[model samples]
Target: MTKTAEAGAAPARGARAVPRSVWALGFVSMFMDISSEMVHALLPIYMVAVLGTSVLAVGLIEGIAEATASIVKVFSGALSDRIGKRKLLAVVGYGLGALTKPVFPLAGALEWLVGARFVDRIGKGIRGAPRDALVADVTPPALRGAAYGLRQTLDTIGAFTGPLLAMGLMWWTANNYRLVFWLAVIPAFVAVAVLVFCVREPTLPAAARPPKLPLRRSELVRLGAPYWRVVGIGLVFTLARFSEAFLILRAEPAGLAPMWAPAVLVVMGLAYALSAYPAGVLSDRRPRLDVLLVGLALLVAADLVLAFAPGLVGLGVGVALWGLHMGFTQGLFNALIADSAPAELRGTAFGVFHLLTGLALLLASVIAGALWDAVGFQGTFVCGAVLAALTAAGLLVLRRKA
Candidate 1:
């Protein structure tokens, strides 16, 4: 080909590549995750060992915090749609989350800890739907799955790195949990800064920027059956998988050192990060629901492994499976929501989906905590496996219907 033709083709090919905003959003997720995970890796242990809290308390705290985030997404997402401005809400959310970082180190009582977690998750809630919607808005539909996967991959990188960093700092500070919490504050601010300076919002034409609220009955009807079906899948999936706090709790009895329990998250994060991008790329080419079914099977396996494992090796295997499940499903679900909803209501779609899943998580975590107290850890995991299997069966039926 002529040099002029070749040059022209190069620009056309480049036009199909993933956009810069997606990468920036991924980094934003990464920084926030690093900040959050460092505290999370140690929070359960700190509560149980230092603050003398019960396992039930840990479960309740994690469940409530996450559920709050889920419920909050609906409002924030709707607001973003109403304003036709995603980045502003995202900035507010990230800022709130960053501000709450200091509270963790200062928390001495369960109430303080719970309050801080609640506030932080509210920040998460504020940002979650809008940020996800922003991803869909900025990227082309053809690259949606890959875009979600890229974001999930970067976020998981931070997820794993935070725990790894915490593990190192734990030893450095002689297992000082508070000091590690203090250090976590740094990344939260960085995440906000990145969001402010790096990512650009896609421009909507003046005529397209209507002042309609997503909550209207007419708007709700427009969301349709496909979107609700996705919500059903999310609800069932969330019910089968409770907070990762339970995983950390299980690690000690599985024979990990208390100081090293954070390593469990590190392992999960590694598997999640490695698999996310590949899963995203595959989903972009193949059937999304098919990829999700594989993820569901992995979750059932992970639960069974955890339910009957003999030692730390078994636990690690289970954790790795859980990570793989996350890598396979999470991004696909996001892409599905983006695909299923109208471009204008993407924020509302994510919000409703998160709200349903969040409610399920609250119930699941509470039930898991109760089971842990009543029938021991084995029983809790066995319950998870059963729910996961049920979810898998449901997905199969849905796949056929689709």
Candidate 2:
């Protein structure tokens, strides 16, 4: 068979076996998540208690950090498409992230911390779209959902593990947040090493390579209606879900001690890790929109439970549901994007999707924080429930139209 034909051919065994490169990419994601989450699980409390920042400040920083990453993704993804290369950019991004790990522990002032976060998020933006596009390139079409899910699953494992480690170190060292942050540097470097030595980028078929400038109007227009529809749904979903930092904040008032606060992420991460792969596999078999609707319903339920239910029990249940919603939706969105966009424009599609959704998240988080400061956590969560419910209704309408 010709090279293009061979590149497009389906794997004989189907979704049962994915390429080794996909697994390597998954591990790369997992290790990086572990390193990042270790610091993140405790960063809010550190800013509040140690640095004396207000809740609104926390919201602004978190929102700005993520929005910065999303913005970078647009350019990095397009650049990857333009050059027909993904691995080099991925390496650069991951390397930047690894290099930034030490800054978290070294920062003594709030300004320093903010600077660190900004730089770190830029690295995330650089890698995010290219890495995702690379996954789509390497994996067979039939296994895209499974590949994304598996990557998410491993990433979530690191997400929880980081917090778990931080919690233990806190107890062992009498809440030494800096020490935990320092140790996190280890996994960040490990992630960079794994990506450098293990993951391999697949060559694109001749027909699937983009022109000189993938970001031009004509090229973007080729992304088509289906891709835009997925982007719309993704935007609404992001608006309904704000920063997870709020969950940690909520844990404090819900009766958890300061040192044990990371438990919130631990619970949430476990739920996410456990469900993501299964959800991915299921999405492969079922109508993806139907699966996504269920995820939206879970988000609504989580918000209500968080808003009204009392005590740690309520917090646990709500957080678990929130994690479940993440598991069900996050990978599926990527899978949907891959399914909708042309192979040549996949990186651009992911970049645009992330950029729009990240802006929505910034808006949502600011609103959530303002509500928390003015009324209380209950008001913030209740508003989230309403938005999630509305998004679900919108999805149903879209389904009907489809």
Candidate 3:
């Protein structure tokens, strides 16, 4: 069947039956996240404790790595639009990511770790927009929010599972970081294999294909104002939410040991995984802006808790709230972009969205690091709360105007 026909042919069961390809892609994301998270859950602590990097250095590395990926997404996303294909680039990206997994175990120096991180993020950048576009391509409009939410749910399952495993391995190996890194390599390759075998790209109709130069000024202008508004919201959101690395750091000062640090992510991931699908379904049934407002409220609460609640209990509460906010917001934002953008420009829209948000993240993370260094974690989170409040206020004004 043609891609369009297949996408529109929803099962008799309604939105409960997401497409098989979407499910497969979700699993693909899950496995890769499992691999990536296992490494990341340990990385912040590893950098600070073993590698002896400063808080500011960690922020710079994390910011730069993510920003690099976002920058690459622009070109990769445009190329997918230009060529009328997405799966090939996704394969290459996943493959490159899998290949880089070993470098983490082998690297003896901070520079080597940074280099591997840079390359891995490049792979992430390459695949992100195309994979997101592919999801939009296969799913019907009515189910888009649910589809993205389900994917986010599965991805978050991996996110927590990876940390759970890392925590276990750390206990098992007597805190052997290298061994954990080595074992993380397996799931990444499994993710690549699944993407290659299970997921199939939808064929775009000739009329639905983008222009020859999808990134050309004239072509981009066709994305229209609504899409740009969504992009603007995304930037503000990113600016308010900085790197999660700081979460791990927060636990350390609260009396968490190095081996148990991954537990922070485990708490957050559980909250995120559990809430994501429900939040997505809620958006589909209700107004997305309402759901997003709740998310912003959660962020404000989380920041306040993180800033003043005191001790590990407070840290746990704040982190879980942070995860809940993520569950509510992340997939919904993607749905908003899909809802607003032209069908042919979906990939480019996601690319630009990621690029601008990523730049915001870089600035946010840097500022967060500086604040953490200059004043304390209290200042860092308080700033986040203030930003979230401001963003929420802005959104309320816009909603009233609308």
lDDT for each residue of candidate 3 in 1-402, tens digit (9 for 90 to 100):
235654877533334578888888889889999999999999988998898999999998999999999999988998888887899999999999999999999999999999999999999999999999888888877788888999999999999999999999999999999999999999999999999999978788778777577888988899998888888888898889899999999998888888888999999999999999889888888889889999999999999999999899999999999999999999999999888888888889899999999989999999999999999999999999999999999999878876
TM-score for each candidate, following the candidate numbering: 0.95, 0.97, 0.98
**lDDT for every model?**
0.88, 0.90, 0.91
Sort by TM-score, top down from the best: 3, 2, 1
TM-score of 1: 0.95
Clashing pairs in 3: none
lDDT of 3: 0.91
List the candidate 3 regions with Cα displacement exceeding 4 Å.
1-5, 10-15
lDDT of 1: 0.88
lDDT of 1 by residue, 1-402 (tens): 111111222221122366777899999999999999999999899889988988887888889889999999998988888787899999999999999999999987889988989999999999999999888887767677888999999999999999999999999999888889999999999999999999988755545443567878788788899888888889889999999988988897799998888899999999999999889888888999999999989999999999898799999999999999999999999999998988777888899899889989999999999999888899899999999999999889877877
Worst 10 residues of 1 by lDDT: 1-10
RMSD of each: 4.0, 1.8, 1.4
- How should the candidates be ordered by lDDT, best one leading? 3, 2, 1
Top model by TM-score, which number?
3
